[model samples]
Target: MAAGQVDELRKRVNDDWERIVELLKQKIALGSVSSKGIAADHMKRSAQFVADELIKVGVDAKVVQSTNPDGSAGAWEVIGSKIVNEQAPTVLLYAHHDVQPVPDASQWDTDPFVGTEIDGRLYGRGSADDGGGIAIHSGALQALGDDLPVNIKVFIEGEEEMGSPSFIPFIESHREEFDSDVIIVADSGNWSADIPSLTTSLRGNTTLDVTVSVLGHPVHSGQFGGPILDANTLAAMLISSLYDEHGDVIVPGVASQEVVGGLQRDLDEASVRADAAVEPTYTMAGTGSLAERLWTKPSITVIGMDVHPVEGSFNVIANQTRIRLSMRTAPGQKPQEAQQALAKYLVENAPFGAKVEVTPLDNGMGWAMDPDAEATQDALQAMKEAFGVDPVNKGEGGSIPFIPELQRIFPQAQVLVTGPEDPKANAHSPNESISLSGLRNNVIAEALLLSKLGGE
Candidate 1:
């Protein structure tokens, strides 16, 4: 915990940069998508890979298997522990090893599964989403060597990207194994490439699959174009009705909350356009500050649709259309409440007397924590000391469904969400990457956090 010790730890992490990249590349090459059969096997290997790395740092590590909610084999969960002092407070470090499937490799600048470094940034599918997280934990522990200050528990999950279908049962079945005083989720993003951030809140999510039927079978467009309504057209109208001209959700019962005053980053029109790849001439939608719309309000997106391809020149009226709807709720909104509101709107607003059926797909609750808590103060101080700048408190628009669950399981534990992702990281998208400097700073901050929380 001395200045020289901190300097040495930073030096060690910097020296091991290549090794960290190699380990990340190895995991990226495994293709651990839970939906694929081979992904299960790859995930097991990924878990063991983490365990082995932890063991190299003198930690007791092992791979544990559990069943998915549907009674199928689930991805392996790795648990590594280093008990420097049993009396010290336990620190749990959390990260996921699984990567999302490459939807279309053609869209990427490089192979999505191959970790590539260009201009000091490592790029790949999982390179930033969580592969960086895995490396951060390993790098921090490795830097500590035999001088680790606290009882450390490292948890690497394999099914986070897949919505953690097995997480509830897995945690319930092994509650004691994950007991800790503080939990740090290394799966969020920094405010920017140079500005570190601590995520204070995460939005919850709900999804619905809707099917609309207007006719018994396909009919010639010319014969029934005016008199008979097509399911596809009706589906389009129904989806459009979910939003008003301002691009805000029109559902009546969904909730919204005001973000507390703080040093929030202003997401301007230019930044939004660049980040979203929007057309330069397009005008921004919604009726609030960009930050308010993005971080403190409900948003709806049409994720997928099942309809005839336009390339085939289908002039026939389709009998049915299926659509997938994904909605992100405000922090204080419950997923169930949002789901019901969405379902009610879709059902009541169906056009052309179409027969509609709405099926609930999944739901994840939002999470919020006090930024001034004792552990959070320690984290902020550590980050400031390590990065030489004040860390910003931010709210994530995306959902980490299991975070609230972890809070519920360990009500007394302080949750700290921090990571290496920046706006340009583009996690779960093509050309995902991470800044090497950011990774190094993350390792330093985490190491210092562990030391400080250990009462050093």
Candidate 2:
């Protein structure tokens, strides 16, 4: 593959940018929220949509069924392949079709299900987190056409947002279908919009639902307010115990490995504050470098709570309070160990003699890659060529769970984690978006990588 040929392919991808955006908009509108079973139908439709697009681009595509952990039906996994050179190494391209639920739609600038362009960015749920990823795969293939140098395998996951509970089993059940020499997980973000990034490590994750009960039934607050222990108060107290005064995780036995000389790109505190909409008076928490705290340290968060709204004004002692706890384990930490630590912490620290119950929801191990691997070097070069700038190397605080699963299944395969998201992309949050130019550049990079890997 000559440099001139790669340039030509990149130009073709740029020329087809509008079509790619349109295809992405169609996917975003499907509302394929995997956590909500009611959206299963739409998720299947989304998978089929991806298959159809791949077919249109001359790839053989199909939708495969997956079984959920609870023995219930799961979303469809779209598998597409194009074997241009049988002797070349196969590259598996991965992204998810399912998206996070729009909890409070009112927070979005535009309709959460509608892809709206504002200031050179596309705003909508899944726009950057993964919809842009799907577009990148399709656009890259379309740009290469039948002249693709690699044997390509496309795996658009169906339930990544739901922690990919069915992924391991699904992959195990059809090992041959997922066989590849290299895997590119397009579900991470860049260091900044101007600086492209290659994700070298991912945090592990585990989740549990905790409930505290102090009373069998609600009682009038006026009569019991002085002595009664409301479930809400007990829950809050137990949750508070998991954090120290400095906001660092105080959970016992969770591993925190030091990240020594992998990717030294520290997140800019001011940019993080601005992107998160933090007030100017707010102080950052935890000890150590921002990168260390974010990528190599354990963290706990209360993702959701089941409590009565203040607007209702019941004025009663609540009988029970339920909260969903998400714990992010640092690389080299096992998620099950973290889950056990969290469960033990919650049970032993129940406040005011309140009964506490903790149920483990999901667990996934974290993964770290050798930055000096041959495939990684090739990918770095490809990204540099595509973006016309040196790409930064970084570690993600968030867990992709399945990345480790893929590494386990294909120990010999090199996994390349890259994506179109940036800090300002706001993935899994309100007003999520992707920069149009960033998406285009990512497609070009991926195309160039495939070409380079095939040549190798």
Cα-based lDDT at residue 405, candidate 2: 82
Clash count in backbone of candidate 1? 0
Candidate 2 matches the true fold with a TM-score of: 0.81
C-alpha RMSD values across all candidates: 3.5, 4.4
**10 residues in a row with least lDDT, candidate 1:** 259-268
Q: Global lDDT for candidate 2?
A: 0.86
Candidate 2 clashing pairs, residues 3+ apart or interchain: none
The C-alpha lDDT values of all candidates are 0.84, 0.86
Question: Candidate 1 has which clashing residue pairs, if any?
Answer: none
Q: Give lDDT tens digits, candidate 2, residues 228-304.
A: 87898889999888889998888888778776335456778987788679999999888778888888899888999
- lDDT (10s digit) by residue, model 1, range 229-337: 8898899899888789888878899988766335456666788788789987787777787777777788888899998787886789899999998999988889999
Candidate 2 lDDT trough over 10 residues, lowest sum: 257-266
